[model samples]
Target: MRTKQIANRFREVILDGLWIANTNYKDQLSNITWEQATTRVESLNTIALLTFHINYYIEGVLNVLKGGALEIRDKYSFDAPKITSEEDWKILLNSLLDNAEEFASLIDTMPDEQLDNYFVDEKYGTYQRNIEAMIEHSYYHLGQITLIKKMLSNE
Candidate 1:
């Protein structure tokens, strides 16, 4: 019973970080193409890159949970597709949402106390830090997404 409560709390954190409030950047940036999505008016990274980066962490965490190491190589580089076609862009957007749900599910079902038991990655920090970092990381990128949209809409 206690485990379930902790699991529920972790699930809430994941949901709140990834979607609950969500900063509404995705909603405002709706109907954007993958091309424009990655286009930065200045030195700033584009929405596609931000979105990709966000998912990149989610993917990386899921991988770590599945026994992969905390890879800090160039693998997390912003390398998402520049969708010229509207259908492709839509697919990516939906995929992100679905993946976030999947991530939350993973956290929700996990043994509650295992949240800090460390997966033991030698190269990177413990699983504890990684999971906690995702919340701040996602929020940081949300700011970027919001600013990028504001910039694009202004010009």
Candidate 2:
């Protein structure tokens, strides 16, 4: 697997919009008010919850890439702190965007040999697989956010 190719895909999915869709997390979550973000839509996760949930893995893997231990716990994935105002929501979005850029940069610098190596353990599959998973995970939640935003707008 070519690391740059994989990294490019990661950037496209995380920050830049991919060819498969015209919007990415950056575009989808922009200028969202706290009311729209925290508003519940049926049984689906709130936009805030889903946004934080998607970044949970990215932040975890990013920590590992930065030489920290993996600190992710599935139980706390959706436990984003209370967002009482727009400032709180923007803070979360900014953190997500910052991490996305840093994570993509880390992936771009990964040596080809490292890409094939297992991430943390064999159970988690290769680094390539893990990075791709982050991309897929982001896209999946991006769709959810888009839908939730549309619903909040009564569209």
Candidate 3:
């Protein structure tokens, strides 16, 4: 039950369905062009950068969920690959969406009891803490992406 709720929240942020913000990553990013995604707004990070940043943690946590190591680092989270063309942008977006789905799916199948277990190490807190943090973090960047899109459109 708890796991399902957490997974659903994850899905609601990245994939289909909307409960908190009324918009998901797929919906918000579907019509965004490569040019717009890569466009800069003052010192703000580009939409593409935010997208990559969000997925960085998702993929890292995802690996841990799949019985792998916690290999992501904060310093390298924004080291997004260059988006040189529409194909490049599409590839990045697709990867994010794909990983997001997989991440949520893994969480959905997670045993509720596992949520209490420490993730990677004690310093990182429990699986539930990290998962919830991902959801919140995604939402934070999602808002930035939406605002960046609007700023780009207005320019």
Candidate 4:
């Protein structure tokens, strides 16, 4: 029930089927070239960097969901790899989408009761909180990606 809802929310933001926002990461990033994604718009973070940042948390939480340790760090979230070529950009985009699907699938299988349990530690709050934060956080960056794309197109 709750897990399904959380998973749906995550899918809505990262994959397809728009609900809260009219777009998703796959929809936004699929057509962007490596040059466009890596282009700087003023002092804002590039679309590639933003994409990596969003996936960083998803992959981290996914590790814990899969019974691994929480190994993600804030300082390293934006440390995106250099997307020097079309292949590099494609790899990062594919990884983001793939990890997002896996993360959502894992959430979909979680028992409702597990959502109330601590994620990796009490400091991080419950699974529900963390998952919700992921959705919200993804949306926040998704908006940025959309704007950055628009800015690039206008240039």
* TM-score of each candidate structure, all chains considered together: 0.74, 0.95, 0.98, 0.98
* RMSD to truth, every model: 3.7, 1.3, 0.7, 0.6
Minimal lDDT window, size 10, model 1: 9-18
lDDT of 3: 0.92
On residues 27-93, what C-alpha lDDT tens digit does candidate 4 reach at each position? 9999999999999999999999999999999999999999999999999999988999999999999
Which candidate would rank higher by lDDT, 2 or 4?
Answer: 4
Q: Is candidate 1 or candidate 4 better by lDDT?
A: 4
CA error at residue 62 for candidate 3, angstroms: 0.5
Cα distance off (Å), candidate 1, residue 18? 10
- In angstroms, the error of model 2 at 46 is 0.8
| Model 4 spans with C-alpha error above 4 angstroms | none
Query: Candidate 1 lDDT, tens digit per residue, 1-155?
Result: 44354334344433343444444434544657766786787999878777777777777677666666766445645877666666776776776666666766676667766666765544556545666677667666777777787788798
Best by lDDT: 4
Q: Identify the superior model by TM-score, candidate 3 or candidate 4.
A: 4
* TM-score ranking, best first: 4, 3, 2, 1
Residue ranges of candidate 3 with Cα displaced over 4 Å: none
lDDT string for model 2 (5-81, tens) is 88888778768865867878887888688888999988989999888887788899999999898889999898899
Q: Clashing residue pairs in candidate 1, if any?
A: none
Model 2 alpha-carbon drift over 4 Å, by segment: none
Query: Candidate 3, TM-score vs. the true structure?
Result: 0.98
State candidate 4's TM-score: 0.98
